[model samples]
Target: AQLFFISNGLSVGFASIQTLTDKSTGLKKGIKGDLTTLRPTIMTAVPLILDRIQNAIESTINKSRFARIFFAIFFSQKKFWSYYGLDTPLINLIFCRKFKAALGGRVKIIACGGAPLSPETHQFIRNCFDLKLLQGYGLTETSASATIMSLDDTSVGFVGQPLDGIQIKLIDWEEGNYKVTDKPNPRGEIVIGGHNVTNGYYKNETLTKESYKEENGVKWFLTGDIGEMFPNGSLKIIDRKKDIIKLSTGEYISLAKIEAELKKCPFIANVCVYGDSSKEYVIAFIIPNASHLKSLADKLSKSGLSFKELCNDSEITAGVLQSIRQIAKHSKLHKVEIPNKIKLCSEEWLPENNLVTSALKLRRKNIQDFYQKDIHLMYGNEHKP
Candidate 1:
């Protein structure tokens, strides 16, 4: 397989990020052009990038009335069902080619990492591109990826098993109340020891000592990530050990998982799930998907409403919250895990706002602080839905 690298050089030790800019000069194009013109066979990206790509395809499809109707009519047919089965080649040859063409028509596989991709987004991309989305798991401490899904692996909801030469173990985290001795799926903090694993944090002795521990003669790095080991040996990350918070009712909640599920709502573009030990139920700060919101407003004959007005509208808020509940229900999230109060924001979270990391993961604390007033207002009321 041929590989082409495109990056700001973060992986290769180019730490001077000030030199990077989006300006396209001469014959070289920007990131958008590079992806669409270079026609790469395999692409590696975070799930957020994949989400944008999926959104673009969906937007294009929605632009064509005939295409939208065709898809709606055919998606329920046996032909599309076969696409989910072994006879997918025909599906790609017929329906998926147009979507593939949008991606320079050559990408065969996309390797997604950095953050958890919602299963809804995962299946949409696979069906649209007729390409396998291979999920990998790792952190900077593990020297990139410790495990990558194989080409033939089609499993959903879990990252892959450990890579060769890497040893992984789960230790019970008493604070999170996760015990390896639990029945069915046992979850705990992932401990990794491998040649690829970093020795310790540079020039930080206290941090190094706290994160890296010696069990017997083997040295292992505590990932701080909570994960469940399936019967099939695949690992599914549930949340960060440090990020898990116990609600006032004494129920533990994974904010990351809740946010991921909330993002599956069509009307929500981005979300930040916030809760504290004192809060009984979680609250969400959401950025509505502009196009989906417009569609909803059009149906409601409220198309002239401004972004802020639309966000605050009772009808719009009720509809979006209902969608979020449906997604949570489909994900089988507990009632405690669902956000009982939601506040919508018109501003999109961008790097300039410092609300998201470079990999597009939410800076949860920052977002919560940014929306503190709105959150207070939501709680000031009963916050039904």
Candidate 2:
């Protein structure tokens, strides 16, 4: 992105995470701080960064009862007008301007990629900032360009249509029961064929042949990502082929999908859902949001405990599990899809720890190995619903 901007004669500035989040440096200049100093009109970020911004804004708003009430009323009003293809400038000026100022007050666009942004966060950003928060979909093999949401698109959850010269096709996955012939919307594995697709993996002919193919003289890359096509030509990624696991009851669950949904819960910062074919239920390893965990501890009258102790408190664990179940139900997950047990941890999974990738994607095998004991203990007392 920086190269593209520079090639186009646009000036680009970079800021490290330390520069942005370091309280000593940022707070010294006032609330807006370095971002306000930059005053950037356009920004690009991953879903993780965007999620943090959303969480921070929510945390600030929730600190005051009147602020929460004011935000709720205006948010609804703005959302209502947005549905009719209208803008509430008054609401933006009065209610959202303060929130927008935290990001420099000049941010006109935010492009999000790397991971799927939850529908709730997507809408929250759009309404709160009153700016274009475009969600995009792509992989490194495609040179990081594929589908990007249009600025005029008001819908949430869909990644939008393909880019110019990019062609997409969906093939049925029989084992997963995703079909291109499904009613209302065609669902299947996404395959990309275009000039942007890579020729092959270097010195790995077997993997290259398995994932890449030529049909009708066009090279295609099988994404292994399940998608549903809308009547308007938009695409919504629904699952991942590699993330599907079957339970003892013969029901298949998409771990990626469930994790995405559960992350919407305020208590959860990150989670890994695990299913055993020998068991009828699933279990999860959760990394709790530190601020939210502290709040939870306060609510349970268990304040002053260390982070590790808070994680192990039986009441707190049970409370968090209840909250997770509530969020899963709200997300319309099946009964079996809701994890039967969860083990909360104070330690975050990071690339440095080898529990997650640099892109923040879970290194499933590493995470499982790291928490094998917790997994066993949770499953030992598992009961089928």
Per-candidate TM equals 0.82, 0.92
Residue-level lDDT of model 1, residues 1-385, one tens digit each, is 1212434322221211221212212233534345454666766667766676666567767889998887666444523564445545665677788777766688788888989877767777777777778898988888875777777666676788888988888999988888899788888899998777788999999999999987676778899998899887789887797668888898888888787777767677778888866668888888887788888899899999988899989899888888899989998999999888787788768777999887778888788778877877767654332
Residue 84's lDDT within candidate 1 is 46
RMSD (Å) per prediction? 5.5, 2.9
What is the lDDT of every predicted structure here?
A: 0.76, 0.85
> Cα deviation of 127 in candidate 2 (Å)?
0.9
lDDT score for candidate 2 against the true structure: 0.85
Which residue runs of candidate 1 sit more than 4 Å off their true CA positions?
1-33, 55-87, 312-314, 381-385
Residues 1-385, candidate 2: write the lDDT tens digits.
8988999998787754334542323255444445666877898777776777787778778999998898889999988898677978889889879778877788889898877888888898888988898989999888888899999999999898999999999999999999999988999999999899998899999999999999888889999999999999899988998899998899999999899889888888788998887898988999887789899999999999999999999999999999999999989999999999899988878778999877778898898889887877888855322
